[model samples]
Target: MGFFDNLLLNLDASVTGLFGQWNIWTSLLATALVGFLTYQVATRQDPDTHPFLLARQAQGTAVRQPGESPVYRSQAAPHGMLLNAGLNVKDPGASKWSRGRDGDLRDVWRQAVAGVQEPGPTKGAKGRILTVLGAEKIVEHNLDDITRQINLIGQHIADQGGNRVAIYLPNSVELLATLFACAFYNLTAVILPFDQPDDAVISMLRRSATDTVVTAPGSFPFDAVVKNYPSLRQLIWVVDEGSKHMDWNEVPQGTGGSVNVSTWQDIVNDAPLDAGKTLPPLEGQKEPRDVTVFWQSKPGQQEEMVRFTAGNFVSAIAAQIFAIPTSQRMGPSDLFLPADSLANSHTLVLTLAALFSNASVAFNSVASQADDLATATGGIAPTILVATPAALLKLHTESKPALSSFIGSKLHWLQTRSLTQKGMMPAAGGLLSSYYDRTVRPALGTTTTTTTPNKKKLRLIVTAERVGADTPKLSSAVLSDLRALTGARIMYALTAAKVAGAVTQTNFYDYRVFDDKCSHFGPPLTSTEVLFRDTEQYKTSDNISQGEIIVRGPCVAGMEAALGVAGKMREDNTLAYV
Candidate 1:
């Protein structure tokens, strides 16, 4: 065999060993590529036949069903318990944009800085900031430096078997760097909110089983936690050069605090600064199965760990379902003013939906009232906006003119989520009618088509808030009434919450709720399973006409095998049925 054939043989063997079932499909794709290339060579009577043109033709041939469309197998699946099907698209050159002649993320960011016109004579300092809440000087923080620091931190953590790290700090550049560092090493990062009571911090530390605690110097005087928790092996505090906690500043000879405080400069100096030298392979390939974060539900409850796989990040499932096409009408130049707490996987959805298009993400610490959001959005002239139902209601009620102006002129798409299904009933008719008649229909901008016609249209993705089944079913109900009475959106009341167990016995217009269930009220996205029980043992929908809404999927955090349990589980415990 020739060199290429021998290389292919080795590649097939390695891939097959890595992912047994997936390799068969991979081999098929490779075969398809060769066949298509051969066909192109034989049939291309003209030089103008591009690869895209050939691929389109190949797609047409592959999908022969009438009125049935060809599905890009990589399309992200819904958030559910089961593992997603189809090929994951993250191995190499994974960006949606082919990194062609234009640029990569680095190049685009640089271009964005150079392209925006500085407002005054202040040169580069005069322009608007992309991220307002992060970094000391976002404009000045070098991406290269951030990347190097990330590597150094990853190396340090990886050397210790990828133990969990708890980061405590105000929203700052160091926090951002630490996040990237943890991502580099595949270490689970628990971002304990800053300014919690010392007791709360201690509880969080113990709950997360944090091995190392990294905090902003003097932020929480959390020495008590270090003293109390046996799991905590080290504490590194980021301090100022001349602060009392500085390395040169000696502690009282008898002071018995085991915590160590160090300056940020010391960390940079001691850790390797080059990405090549510092960043190493995590413990393994770092799939979506690896826990990356811990999220707490109620204030006193232990934090639960959430893992975002490389597949999850790359798939960007939420972003895909909520993105709008980029025509001159609505594209990257558009601004996004997000209420910091309000945006999470949903905003990620918004960013990804637009083909990794760059947009300014402005953060606000204070409650972003409707007027403030509109003012910021208006000044930025963003084509897209994300708001909560409550926030949207406020805007609809408070500033009609500004709202009209946005819907009439700049705004092309609006995505809302967390609305209880009950809430939708009240807002559905009036809001939809007013929104379409007064704004959306009137704007009538030229269409920007990137794919199929419907796929290209602007859309709003609203996730109904979890609700109990105990409300009126009329579609004409007002949003205020639904929210006040049911405390959630209409759809969730009809689905997950209403049908599942409930804390209070109540029945709404269309849902059956079981009250007094502890598991009912936990945030579905953040709760984790303590033990894997038999699927058969789970209370069925027949029990009380309510079903168990078992939590699974990549999003839920805090899942771990319970230790010291009496019985060893069976092989059937491996998969989730819910």
Candidate 2:
């Protein structure tokens, strides 16, 4: 008893001595530390997705090739189940319980016209189509008028015996309507890059075996196209409203009646007033024709024609539709704009998906240019913007140097913490944002002028890196910086030449910066599976599976394509090029 009492007494004495030495400053400091810790614990947030889910995002096959790694697929499709195949397009009057057929491009227009169909009390609604003329002019087209144009164009092409038609115009109402016209009329649509040189355009025509050509009046060398390609049968000139006063029907002197020529405006005007009000009747159950795209491995390389069947495109569209969580899926309330050229398959697929979801779409003629992103999206604010890595890199590089001021740097650091540590996007603008805008943005010079309008309305920025294209690399740190600056989430995709949409895309909610050099492309999409072909130097048995990437799925042009680039599968099952 005496020993216990003495020990207690000594402990109490030590505590009293420690407390007795504490002054007002020390006591205040201790209280502040305790309160800060308590506040932190109370305000902490859960990550966007569970960590375990990220760890095992994809599944591996039980068996593997002799020297290659086991095939990896999205968790959405396991070993025994089938991968995503098509859009599951149900025909009109088909049983609600029956399985849908793999629909063609005609069905895409039908769905857009049908509008949003949902259960319960929500009524169906259609989305508008907007065309940006320039910084000051935006035109909204009526669906009925667009339908009329489609019918006139389709009937004209079919009557002229045009089989394979090349659409060589910039992104405009005419381009979209002509594409749909070909779909409805069962003619193959060949998409050629609008910016190619005259010789390049002629070469593409010969290579694609295109019988019909649709383009602007003065865009290409008309005489050269007719002289070099004897198979050309029809030419439709899409004259702008400003230049329609000039005569565009003049053909070369020696051509005679062999080549039939027409203007888009004349075709629409010549049709009866009530001709194209309603859609043409479905032509029974026949499948639509193929859609061909030109693929260039790099600049100055010969372009190759890649033909994609309706099944390939529909499957890719469906895959992209379901890639996002159901709660976050696009709907009628959103406006989607593709700042990149729709000639790129990835951009085209996403645009179609947006249309299918009943979202408004905007097109700009300045698309596909690296430095014209701001000019393309100047007036309207889009909820979703799809662009190229070059465009985003330009934005990042230009805006970075302006944030060197002490206040701007501190604000950037706080925003970075919100993204990196908290897994949440910072609020778009606040008092601090106003202060930064006035002080820091002025230093940005012309960059401030080129900044996207109403940036606060932007919810997502989708950009991709073509595998073999000569473009700037987007590092994870740069992506993090972009996220901080834009106040919007970014989805970085890795696309290949043979894949319809994308080989793999980063998770929407994944904001981690894994490496400073290259960001990891997330798991294979649900529409496809990926495997690495083992090489002598980089084998599957290494710490990380490394080799060439092999992709296979319905979205692939040939059902399987080998991406001729070195890649590695990380421990977390993400993919990154070596």
Candidate 3:
């Protein structure tokens, strides 16, 4: 062979032999270098030009659809790895399901509609979409209803000049409808976490530039919101207090005094559900890209507002990239288990993704109680499950006896988002192994089938990790171990305390700040750049170290309090006061 080829082979052999019996640390270092070299070589080699050598090697791919913006392409590359894995293994020749229309949001709704069209075995008295609340017989909404809801919401926003409304309710069908309504009408929807402190609620409302606040009456008290936020000019509450005629008022009499009120029935009754058969044409000179939802965050001393542009929803990008060729093979009989918040969001995205692929989603609303999960999901025997470490831990701890069935049956893949520690990964792996042996392999009705074209391989994507390339304890050996456990799909995001405007990062993870600093402000396109002058003056990538991270991305609106908590910003806008 050539000199370089022989040299690489010898080097690999020597390193393997030397580190073979060494401590895990040394072994990890050796293994990591080898892995990195392998990755670099595989990545550099083109699939079409050097197909044989780099065939199975997975390099992260970015997903960019036709007519999509360059911003999207840049942001999608890292995430494309996960999407591609899911799509690559899916079956081909599946029946086509289409909403038969255009528009990003509408298309998602259409896809959801198409998924509900397939016939499946009825679990209860009647057939429908599985819900958490006591709605036994529930299925996806029809095309007509979806279209009307979109138009109605859009009309309301058009009438009002930039109205800001809050969707204060639990995760239910109504909540879903409210989101679509907000998007359709082009009204800004501020999602306030119901579980947060009362002060946090007031702060979010004021920071978001909220003019109108909408909440489901009795869901939570609004004394704090009315008392603290002066920007709120209108208050609309959906009161479902066993009354025939719903209340719609401009002035609501409460502890905070007079405010407007609007009922759910009023909007529904007034909306022309059957008017325009198709979706109303997108209005304004700006396309979906101009639609921006502002987020309230800290940039230094200033409270900067970053708006998430349209068509940049992380879920949309994920759907396009993970579209499976043979996904059309399955009809509506499929079921899905989404246990975590992000995974649940993915389930919602999958509803859209399945429009191109032909799979149905059944909610595995497995109760916290293991027995409840077995009963709810066993009858349908879901083919896909999206979960997190906490939920999986609960399952393992509670369902020791039935664990075999839970693990060995129906679970095609395990997707996790929030990972606090590295030690927890082993337990996750054991759970997966047990799950495969007990549920997945048997449920698919195959033993010899080690791989499938329609199903993505088992790979974990770790988001927001603590120890990274910079951590003293983090070594090549640890990285190799992590890769060996979860494969090469381990993802790391190094977020800054405050940043805006999107920039290309050249490493595995960006530099991270401490706790409660960097919050997600939509897709990466909205991120910015920031740097401290004294602590971090050098612009060169080689000199980056632990200084108060200066963020400069589109999403870095400004510092929530430059003079208060995070410290003050320099004259040039860098956060130097920290």
Best by lDDT: 2
Ranking by lDDT: 2, 3, 1
Write one digit per residue (lDDT tens) for candidate 3, span 1-578: 99999999999999999767689788789899999999667634222122221121112123322221111212333432322111212112433552222245444444454333334542111112444322233344444564565555446544554377665544334445555566655566664533335665576677776776656665445766777776666655555536535444543455556444455556555766565345544434234322223222322223233344333333332333322113323233443433322112223333334332334343433321122323333434334443332333333344334323643222322311111122122233456555544433222211122222123333332222111112112222233233332322232223222221111121122111223322211122112222322233332122221233333322332321111122222221212223
Error of 1 at 256 (Å): 6.6
Residue lDDT tens for model 1, 89-198 = 22234555432221112222233233322233333321122333222212324444645656665565556554777877653445555655665555766666566677
**Per-residue lDDT of 152 in model 2:** 87
Off by over 4 Å in 3: 1-107, 110-130, 135-140, 160-162, 235-258, 272-277, 282-285, 289-306, 314-316, 323-338, 342-383, 399-578
User: What C-alpha lDDT values do all the predictions have?
Assistant: 0.36, 0.80, 0.37
Worst 10 residues of 2 by lDDT: 442-451
Q: Give candidate 1 regions above 4 Å deviation.
A: 1-87, 90-130, 133-140, 157-162, 170-173, 217-219, 237-257, 269-289, 292-338, 342-397, 400-578
Estimate the TM-score of every prediction: 0.46, 0.92, 0.48
C-alpha root-mean-square deviation, each candidate? 23.0, 3.3, 14.7
